[model samples]
Each structure stands twice: as C-alpha cells, then as structure tokens.
Target: MFRKRSKTTENTAATASTAVRPVWTFSSSGWLFLYHFGVIKCLKDLDLHRQVYTIGSSGGSCAGAFLHMDTDIDEVVRFVLSCALEARSSFSGLFQLKRYLKNAIRKFGTAELPNKLEGNYEISVSQLPWLRNRRITKWRDMEDVEQSILASSCAVPLAGLPVNVPGLGYCIDGMFSDSQLIKALVLGNSYFAYHDHASVTICPFYSSRAHITPSEYVPLWWAFFPPSPEELWRVYKLGQKDARAWVIKNRGRTNLTVTPIPDLTDEPEATVLQDGWHAWENVGEEISMLATGAVARLWSALSHVLEALGWTLVYWELAVHTVLSAVVAALAPVLPDSLKAGGSTAMAWKRCRDYYALLLSLKMVLKMVPALGGRIRMGMDAIDRIFSLSFCFRLFWFLKQSA
Candidate 1:
C-alpha cells in the first residue's frame, strides 16, 4: 500500500512539471499595448502567468517584460497611458513617438533584466535590408534591451529609421519578416524543436471568430496619432473582455494558435484549378488588362486636360481684368468721382493699378502651390504597377506550373 501511494505521488509530480506549458506570443502593437495589458490581467487573474512562457516582437517586447516581471497591471496601465499622452502631446507624427519611447526607456529602464529562469521570455527583431527575423533571449544590459525593443518597433517609411543595435546591426520591425507565410512556417518548425510548450496567441484586433475590420485599420494610425483617453480606455476594456471570454472557452486547453493578419504586400498562395493548359483562358485576362490600362490612361489624360484648362481660365481672367483696368484708366477723366467712392480719379486709378498687380502676383504664385501634375503621374504609376499585365501573366504561368 505504501509503495503504490509513493508511485501515485511521483506520477502526479512528473505530470505537473513536464506538462505542456502555455507559450503566449505577442505581436507588435504600438499604442495598442493597452489591449495587451488587459489580456495579461486576465491571465494573471487566473493564476496562469506562472505556467506561461512569453515571446514578443516590436512593441510586444515591452509588454512581454511586464508579463515576465511581478509588475502590477494598474502600474502598467498608468505607464501606457502616460507614454501615449507624452508621445502624442507635442507632435503629430510617428517619429515623435520613437523619440519619446527612447527617452522614457532610458530614464526608466534598468540594466538588469529578469533571467529566463525566472520566467521564459523572448524578443524578436529583424536585421535591416537582409535578415527578416531574429529572436534574442539574452541581453547584456539596459541599453541592449532598449535598443532591441526600439529596433523591433521600427516600421520602415512610417517610423523614421531602423535602430542601430551594437551587436544586432541595423534592424527594422519584426512583423515584416513573420508577415510572410513561408517565413512563419520556418520559424514554427524551429520553435517547436527548442521549446517544449503549446502556444496560445491572443490577438486584440482580429480573429477568425471576430471580424473587427475597423480595428484592423488603426493599429499604426493610432500610434501616429494616439486616440482620446476615453477611446483608449474603451479599447483596453474590450481587450480584457475578449480575453476573459477566450479563457472561458479555452480553459484546460493544451494547444492554441492565432493567425497573424496579412499586409497588403504579402503574397497569397497560388491555387491551380486544372492541370491541363487552356490557351483560351488567356482571352479574358488579356481583355481585363486592356480595359484596366485604357481606363488608367484615360484618367491620366483627363487630369492633364483639366489642369491645363484651369490654368488657361486663370490667365484669361487676368488678361480680361488688365484690359478693363487700362480702359478705366483711359476713361478716368470722363468718369465721375462717385465711381471711385468720392476719391479723386488719379487716386482711384492708382489703387486699381495696385490691385491688378497684386492679383497678378498671387495668380502666378498659384503654380508654386505644389504641382498636381506630379501627383497625377504618381497615381497612374501606382495603377500600372499594381495592375500590371505582366504580373497577371506571371501568376497564370505559375499556377499552370504548380498544377
């Protein structure tokens, strides 16, 4: 009886220690960090944080740190709110947010990071112009951590520049690499080899069960221009509410997965319906290409015509006014002072001349207001690139080969 009881206890202990751990992965979410805070609170409430391992990329790195530490949720809320307010207070661009982030991290960041032994956490970043993704589990000091977080958050064109980390080289946003399915597949294969855990992804924006399209559009927009305190609070609460629902539904679950939203540039998988070649199918494609190209060219030509007509009207108006002013000056002697508002004819004529010159100067400067021509050209170019006939042909050929 004693031997059986000891065996039972040992089995339970082994299961408790070696059971599949929860791997929580967070994607980069700028001001949307509030949503993550709410989710983390839900996890902590259920005493699940102790059993969860975290992986974060970009802005997620900051959230991941908070999750790893014994930090209060309220403290994190205050931190997030304060950071957003400060970053958005004096500026109107994402670059300002970057500056404020660096300053805040330097002021408040500590040189000591909690060891993975304390709680497993990983940060992801992409080395610029070359490598798409790299995950770091160890850090040398406060600066490294700060740089890593900033590097991961760097979105090209939108956010000013990629961060230069001492050992990581120049790096951009981690989302750029993982946004691709092929890259994500590679990462997944490698991730399972080293980490013996089941991952649960909690996305605040969109999910298969929920289609929050409006929220999907604002992830970066909010970072560029942080919303009102009321809106931020609402989003945070929504995240908490969603997370609680998720927990209720997925309680005692061992495996969970969340799909990342694809960007506009992400290549979709090519599907082939038939194995045999059909040359006749090219007719519809060719027709589509011709129609789209003709429409684009027509629009471009119309814009140019309108612009020219607008300028011609402006010039004509100026010429007509000049002729009228000259006629007025010539007839000033014959005209009554009442026509000039009780002023002398000479004074009225001088004022008229000055007004004509002012109008002429202003009209000339209208051309300097910035050219719509370049904008029209840019639009046409975008249409050509996005709806190119060559791309369609290439896609058709690929599908044929794949089939």
Candidate 2:
C-alpha cells in the first residue's frame, strides 16, 4: 500500500538563537571587555556551562560576544574554576592580573597613569567555555593603514579646477573670524592645510612625525617600464588616479609628463593594501580630535554663558550631552576620545560629547548618498587644519597671558 505524502515534515530543532545585541560606547572601550567581565560573573555565580565568548576592537553596537553552548550555567562555571585553579595552583600571579590590567590601561590611556579606573561593570552568565586555541601576535600589516601620516598641513592635493581665489580667500577670511576660527579649527585640524587660492596653491603647516609613504615601496620591476607615468601606473600597481596626482603634485608637473620612477629590485617589499587601510582608518581619529577639541572649548564657554542665563542643570546637561556624543562616536569609523592621549576624566567626557555631535553631522551628511560624505569630509578637513593652528595659537596665548 502506498502511504500518503505529508504536506510538512517536522523535526523539532529551533533555529539558532540570536538575541538583540546591546550597544557599547564603541571604541571608547571594546565590548570584548564583556568577555573579561562576563566570565567573571559566571565564576562568581558558580555556574560554568552557560557562557562561551569571543571579543575584539572591531566595529559594532557591541564590542564582542559571549555564548552559552550547553543550557547549564554550572557547567560554564567550571572553566572559570579551572582558570582559578590554574591561577592558584600553577599561575599564582593571577591574583595581581586585574591590578596589572587596571594600572596598564590607566597609564597607557592618559599618560597620567592613574592607579585605576573607578567605574564598575557587571555581567551575569551561567557557564564557562574552555579557552580555545588562539594566536595573539602583534603583526599589524601595512595595508591596515589608511590614515595620512602626512596631514593636509604638509601634504595636500588639489582637484585641479578653475578655483576662484576671491571665493577661497573669503573662505579663509571668514575662518579667521572668531566664530569662524572655531569652525576652521574643527575642520582643518583633521590634517591641517592652508591654501592661497590667489596663487592657486596649498601648503601644509602642521605635521607631527607624519610621513606619507605607499604601502610598499614601488616595485623595482616597474622601474624597467617606460619612464612615462602611464606605463609605470600599470606596472607599479598604483591607483589609477592618486598615484598620478601624487607624481604631478610632488614632481611639479601639471599635465601628464613622462616621469621616471626609481627602482631597487633588491629592496624589501611588503604585501597588500593593509597599510592603506590603516591610513584610511586613522581618518576617523583625526576627525574626532578636531571635533572634540572644538566642542570641549566652545561648550565649556557655552556652559558658563548658560549659567549666566540662569539655566539649571547646566552641568548635568553637559554630562548627558557628552555621553550621547560618545555613543555616536562609538558608532562611527573613528573620533578622538580627547585632544591628546590619556586626557582627564573631564576631558574624555568632553571628547565623548563632541564625538556625538560629529556623528550626528556625519549621519545627516550621509542621508543624501555619497556627495554629502565627500563634501562634509572635505569641509571638516579644512576645519581640522584651522583647528591645529588654533590649538597652537591657544597654547601660545595661554602661555603669554599667564606669563
């Protein structure tokens, strides 16, 4: 007898669970930190089987994740127990690991080297997964760099157009204005550069051990190609446009001219776009510095002004505003946490606030597709240059005024 075919075949195994993820302050602190804290939570609960984790400083609403493989929290707790046992039995130094981590982070962060951070984080987990085989080596590839070590101040490229000097000059003139000074500072400081459009030229006035080098020195093999850039462009594997622009800008030729590239077949060559990525990635950091620095200074002044206006909760408002800013920055590519490394708690808070505003501006700009991103990036970049100069100016002013 033929059996009737069923409309549905059923075997019960629910699709893997994916919970709604929680957002973090982004790079302000990596969420991988949760793994550091979460397992401790499970250990504290004496639940071992419910938590397994992985974390990193990559992009995200969260830094990393913790998973519970088996349904039992107690089973998870066992790993933490093992780690504790190993620490007590074979690695007694584990007692001081937390202290070491705290001190190291504090020192590395602000250079002030505080004894420790004061905030506490809590996580609850049921179990611990054994540490998997992992490789932790410091091998930053050149392609990871996308940041221009040589900022606009010392290195800028012209788009090569009929630029109106008066218009550009007016732009410069406006920047020198008190309000515009802030604007310029915010934009230009990204990679600080100045332009004298009348001469149709731009120059870099800001640099900090910043150098611009290709990911790998041009391949020596390319040197044998025709001395013309067009040929070298193909053999050197240089970007179709940027490489040509660099040659023209640096070699001082406007139209395509035959140019010879140097060669040393024996010189060491690195691999890939890794360095370019790193360079580009640093753009976020530069943007943040200019943004935060401007906001911290301006908002502080604004706070005083608001206080005079008898606005209550001025400080509280500042705190809220700043936290919001930092969260926004966390979501963006990069924004500086503060003007310099290891800034004060107050300073970091200010950066966070600025980051939020910057992120908002970027989000608005991105709403219109690629145009806004490019234009805003360019405009803010100009402001960043101005910021670098103004920062120096402010320092000098403070020094002289104090003296």
Best by lDDT: 1
Best by TM-score: 1
Q: Where does candidate 1 stray beyond 4 Å?
A: 1-19, 90-93, 103-111, 114-119, 181-198, 207-220, 255-403
For each candidate, what TM-score against the reference?
0.51, 0.16
- How does model 2 score by TM-score? 0.16
Q: Put down candidate 1 lDDT per residue, 54-87, tens digits, no spaces.
A: 7676666676666655667766677667767665
Model 2 spans > 4 angstroms off: 1-344, 360-403
When summed lDDT is taken over every stretch of 10 residues in candidate 2, the lowest stretch is: 146-155
lDDT of 2 by residue, 68-153 (tens): 22123233323323333333453333333223223322322331211111111111111112211111111122111101000100
Question: What would the C-alpha RMSD of candidate 2 be, to one decimal place?
Answer: 29.5
**lDDT (CA) per prediction:** 0.51, 0.24
